[model samples]
Target: MNLTLAIAIIAVAAGVIAAAMRRVPIGQVHSLYRRGQPLRLLEPGTHWVVPGLDRIGHRIDLGGQVLRFEQPQADSHELRGTVYWQVLEPERAEATIDEAPQLIRCGALAALGESPLAAGDRRDLGSRMKQALNGALRERGLMITRVELEIA
Candidate 1:
């Protein structure tokens, strides 16, 4: 009876674990990071992750992505642009999502804020900001295909 009870408990635990883990499918990517280290990219299919330790930071489809930003100066001049991008390394994005872009934004804003262009330096500011974003994206293996500038 004791042996049978032990076997039943083990079976129950296995069942619970099986229920907790899942698979990721293809054509889509899931980012996984644990303890500041990035794991392999989870392709489309079933992906089993640790119940509470590993987390998905972001999911990117195989397709491209777009992001836009605009900054208005006190003098009514503004800088605006759009970025076309795609992921190259899933692991890097998963591990550094929270920090890389934050640092990049601070750097870009500081550069623009200190510039002495009388007309608010919209063109120059936009160029610098795009460069900063490209550098930040490189670390995560994302390619910035284009930066289109426009007045707003």
Candidate 2:
């Protein structure tokens, strides 16, 4: 009976230790939070975290992401294209990481809407939209690498 109890205790301890170990894959970052407050950003590696107290709030991917957006204009033409983006600073983007796609989509639509539809230059429009988006997103740790837009 005594031997069985000792083995059980050791097994339980091992399980607890395993549970506290967290492995964040490469090309990704994790935002750690404690007691509902932001703590720190965890890079790609194996980390030891307090199982219950420390929780991963966000799993931010560092790889480039594509956001496709389509907006119907008042004249029946649709502005559509793909936006290439990536997170440059995980710390700064932690707060709004989940909404990054939506933010980019909305910003693109707004820029397209404000531009003259009769311009007939998709390349120029794409470059302009890229600049406008980069201006707005840089502060949030995000960047627009390229914008491919077409009015159809």
Candidate 3:
């Protein structure tokens, strides 16, 4: 009975040790939460975390990304566009917003022109959308590099 108990304890210890070891890959980062609260962002490479005490909250991509979305304009026209963005601050990105892509989508929807934009109007709309998205997301740590919008 003593031998069985010792073996069980050893197995549990090994499991804890394994759970504590984590390796965050390159180009990606993760936020560690301690006791269900936000802690800190872990950069790429090996990391040690307390098992069952600390947990990874969300894995965030640190690289530049393009998101395509289609939304309706105020005039009932379909507006399609792609947003190019990169994370300027990881901690702010994690804490400031729940989802970045959705925020961009919402911004695009709000900025859509009231009329179906023409070829010449598309350029103007892109600039307008860029400014609008930046206005909404700048405080949230996401920098919008470019916005391309057209009447779909």
Each prediction's total of clashing residue pairs, residues at least 3 apart in sequence or on different chains, is: 12, 0, 0
lDDT of 1 by residue, 2-103 (tens): 999999999998987986676666657877777656666778888678866787766756557766666676656675656666667766665564554455
lDDT of 2 by residue, 46-76 (tens): 9999988999999999999999988887787
Return the TM-score for each candidate structure: 0.57, 0.93, 0.84
Q: Supply the global lDDT for candidate 1.
A: 0.65
Per-candidate Cα RMSD to the true structure, in Å, reads: 5.2, 1.6, 2.4
Order candidates by TM-score, high to low: 2, 3, 1
Give residue 143's lDDT in candidate 2 (0 to 100): 95
User: Model 3 has how many clashing residue pairs?
Assistant: 0
Clash pairs (backbone) in predicted model 2: none
Off by over 4 Å in 3: 1-10, 72-77
Top candidate by lDDT: 2
Give lDDT: candidate 1, residue 144: 64
lDDT of 3 by residue, 1-152 (tens): 99999999999999988999989999888999998899888999999998888998888888899989887766667778889998888888987545888888878877874565666888888888899889889888899999887676
Write down the RMSD of candidate 1 (Cα, Å): 5.2
- Residue-level lDDT for 28 in candidate 3: 85
Error of 3 at 73 (Å): 5.3
